[model samples]
Structure formats: structure tokens, C-alpha cells
Target: MHNINYVLISLLGGLIVPLQLAMINAFRHTSGATQIQSTFFLYVGGAIASLVIALFVDGSIKPPLYQHASWWMWLSGLLGSFYILCIFLAAPHIGATNTLLWVFLGQMIFATMIDSSGFLGMQIKKLDSLKLIGLGFIFIGGLIMIYSEYRHSSS
Candidate 1:
């Protein structure tokens, strides 16, 4: 049951993504900010909020032991920036629903591979038939979303 609470919390995080994209899109339109500028501000705001939260939680914003960390761990910030920029570019053009559907599909596919392979020192979880079926369903849903968007745009 504790794990279920965590799952619900994660789901809440997922629910926020589209809203965040929409807000960012609105901010770009209203502020006349370029994609890069909006993304930069987004990260800046996130950094501030994260620092505040860290201080509140731990009583000090202490740095991690970076000396022991692998080089690839550093790629997270770059990848996150790229992802936000992509979302900023995509959400307005594709519609948030379509953009998120494709994004979620892609995430699930890659996450499954990561889980199965234990990439980045993550615990290995064997990919099973159920997981494949779940992926299949998500892929089918993405196709449906694409078709629906095409029909809506064509009409």
C-alpha cells in the first residue's frame, strides 16, 4: 500500500506534464520569448524551487559526491534541457495530447529496455509477456491518437 501511494504520486507527476507544457507555451506566446529563452527560464525556476526544497528537507543544500559519480550521470541535465526544448517546440504544433501520447509511448519503450537491461546500475527487472502486452497497448493507443489528429486536421 505504501508502494501504491508512490505510484499515485508518480501518476500525479505524469498528469502535470501536459499542463506544464501548456503553461510554458502560453508563457512563450505572452512573453514573446523564444523557445531557448523559455526553456532556460524554466530550468532557472526549477533550480530555484529545487534548491528551496532541498534546504527545507535536509536543512542544507549540500552537494553530492560528484567524484564518485560516473560521467554519464552528468548527461542528465543536458538531456533534460533538450527534452524541455523539444516539448516546447512540439506541444504547440502537435497539440498537447498528441505530443504527450507519443512522448509517453517513447518513454515506456525506452524505460522497458532500461529496466530489462538494468542500465545505469538500475535493478534488473526481466521483461515479461505482460510488459510486452502493455507496450503493445500503448503503441496502439498512440496510433489511434495519430489517426484522430490527422482526421481532425484534415476536416
Candidate 2:
């Protein structure tokens, strides 16, 4: 069974995403920063916070074995930056709930693919009928959310 603590932590992480996006939006408005500038500041803050956490957890930041690292490993930071930029651009126009609904739906779909395929050295988890059903429900829910958001915005 999955650890309850980890599950709760994951849920908390999910909760934080929308709040973070909203805060970033507010920050941009208050600071009069462009989206790209705000994203840059966000990464700078994140890097400092991450470094502090690493130091606390590991006693020091140890260098990775660069020679053994795959080229794809370097793409994580770029991918994360792109994701943040997309969120920054999208949340204000779409509303956070609408943006997040689609984001969550996309994450679920792609994550399922990754798990099933065991891509990037992940442990293979066979995708079954139950998982497909769950994804279908999520997709339906996303459609409902889209409809609601459209009605709310238009009217």
C-alpha cells in the first residue's frame, strides 16, 4: 500500500499549485512585472529555497556524478520553466480553476502513458480497464468544468 503520509503530502502539493499560480498573478500585478520577469523571479526564489532545503537535508549540497548523468536529465529545468511560463500566461486569462482542470487532466493522461510504458526508466505499471475508466471520468469532469467556466465567463 502507498504510504498515507506520502499520499497526504501529494494532495497538499496539488493544493499548492493553484494558490501559487494565483499568488504569482497577484505578484505580477503588484510589481508591474511581465510574465517572463515574474517567472524569472519565481525561479530565483525557488532556487534559493531549494538550496537551503538541500543543505538542511543532506548537510551539504553534493555534486551529482555528471559523467553518469544522461542528457535528458538536463531537460528537467527547461521543462519546468516552460510549464511555469505556460501557467503564468494561462491562469489570468482562463481563471485558475479552468486552467488547473485542464492541467490536471493532461497530467493524468500523460502520467498514465509514462507509467504504462515505463518510459525514462520508471517501473512499469500496466494500464488496465479500471484506470481507463478513471481517466474517462476525469475527462468528463474536465468537460463539465470547461462548460461551467465558459457559461460563467460569457454571461
List the RMSD of every prediction in angstroms.
Answer: 1.2, 1.2
Per-residue CA lDDT of candidate 2, range 14-100, in tens?
999988998999999999999999989999999999999999998898788999998989999889888999988988887898788
lDDT for every model?
Answer: 0.91, 0.91
Q: In model 1, which runs have C-alpha deviations exceeding 4 angstroms? A: none
Summarize candidate 1's per-residue lDDT along 1-155 as a digit string, tens digits. Answer: 66998999999999889889988988999999999999999999999999999889989977789999989889998999999998788888888988888888889999999999999788999999999999999999888988987998899
Could you tell me every candidate's TM-score relative to the true structure? Answer: 0.95, 0.95
Specify the poorest-scoring 10-residue window by lDDT in model 1. 86-95
lDDT value for model 1: 0.91
